[model samples]
Target: MTRFGFRYRARRRVLAAGVLAAAVLAAAGCGGASGSASSSDGTVVLRVPDPGNSGVLARGKKDGSLAKALSAVNTKVAWTGSTGPFAPAAQQINAGQLDFSQGSITSAIAALGQKPGFKLFAQIAPDKAGEGILVRKDSPISTVRDLIGRKVAVNKGGTAEYLLLKALEKEGVKPDQVKRVYLNPAETAPVFNSGQVDAWAVWAAYSVPEISKGKARFLVNGDQVGSQNYSIWAVRTRFAEEHPKVVQAFYEYLRERGLQQIKDPAAFINVFTEAGPQAFNGAARELTISNLRQGAAAAPIGAAQLADFDGVARFFADLKVTPAKVDVKPHVLSLAGSGA
Candidate 1:
């Protein structure tokens, strides 16, 4: 389909989906509620992922602005003490144990393939340099073709794996020519640095520190590989339907803070550094700020986001990573004024 045709189709399907969501919400009310708890006075306790380790969320929570803002909408924040590897977070959202979290498009696609428990309500454009294939500075393998016959570490069904597939395809290399070691982000660094894996396909959280420390360099990034792995926020379908106002408020909070983060990247980066053990100090910290400066802020979902979602869904289906291509329009919703 032409670009305009695809976008128009997306808008129509999304509108239909929005109506369906409202109906689901009404049905949920009759089913005795499926999301976070509400008190006798009717204040919603929004159960969300812990923000202590994340840059934007952590900063917002620490300064009390996030809480104060939510109170105005008759919602209370409940920190669920969880961070991400978003697949598990997706599962939590499905089970109603969590309400919201941010993850890559690949994770959302994979989760939706299993169950339609959430809707992608917001998106951040791909951070091209933030995710890629990482190799030790002295590794003999320097190009995508060099990856043939080599072992690479990647999080199965995640951005790293997606990027690897794209990178290999771009270089005209077949997937089976390389041995892919499926490992979570935490396990990748140890195996890659110890020479157990020839290279690690990873995102910024893991790749940046190594790159800044001079231990590794990018063999290829999302930009070179033609990646569509945008960063996305998922809210439980029930939660969003039951509390649309709260969801919109949260999105607004993120959008505003994200804009501020872009303007003064260091302020947010400093909060990120102080929040956890994985300190991106000195050059690493500076590199992160630079990435943030170039990064796209979060915004309500739109046609561009829908197009990206469909692209990822089709890519995964073709690779057999997913059983079938997902019709992303039904599984996503655009809030008022969010259309592209």
Candidate 2:
């Protein structure tokens, strides 16, 4: 919060930039948003390529929601395409690999701690609906406290991990008291459903399918614990500075488009997965649609949201999830000059 601290963080980013430049050069043409490109027609092209699992932003092209918004400001787009989560995509952005990405606050804090030189552009969907820890519907682990000494599956270093930490704290339990089985999505359902892990702390995506089947029941959810995954949009800092107008267009687009998606997630899932129906199967997509309606709330980037960032940062620090405290305030941008 002090001037010196700000300078120190800035210096760290400068150093990280040098390292990122090397990574960019080494991994050229690998795929996804390619370093702020332009089209041959003398039009400026902004690359996003990936919209992560949700594809909420990427789907904007279908309705011309993003394209029209950007074109209104004289910008064209080049799709580098989407692959994985935000951390890697964010790395590509910092390394000049991509120009933008969206992710949960926990991952963004980790990215910030790494000094990726990306700025938080907007808060997209802050929802208290899906964060949950589940056990078999007939299981005896009926409450958060009941998980004491029992194994819970979580994707370590991701949102689910943070949920477990906060859930335990709210229930007056220490983290180590429960067994944590760390697994990615591919391995989670089998391990969890077979009773290899007594409970699974997860939100949306992989968790939704199982819960929708009526095989599992929630022991606790974000609404119950007063926590959430504040999903956000982030831009590579250099790109935003060089093309402020372009960034502003995306800001306006995300705000307007995100509201539309949250209001009708079923429609969003339809558009987002039309090309790749396998992206989310019938069960998962339906569950997501239900949760999005019940959970998603849209808000402008502001003090209250920033405070949530601080609280999550402290949670990361306490769990030693992040190496040290990351001052997230400096990187958040205001939409003043952006076309409202």
Clash count of each predicted structure: 0, 1
TM-score of each: 0.88, 0.82
By TM-score, who's the top model here?
1
Q: Write the per-residue lDDT of candidate 2 for residues 248-334, one digit (tens) a residue.
A: 777766666556666666556545444352355566556666666664433456887788889889888888888887788898877
Report, for every candidate in turn, its global Cα lDDT versus the true structure: 0.73, 0.65
Model 2: lDDT to the true structure: 0.65
Q: Give candidate 1 regions above 4 Å deviation.
A: 1-33, 272-276
Worst 10 residues of 2 by lDDT: 1-10
Error of 1 at 219 (Å): 0.4
| RMSD value for candidate 2 | 8.0
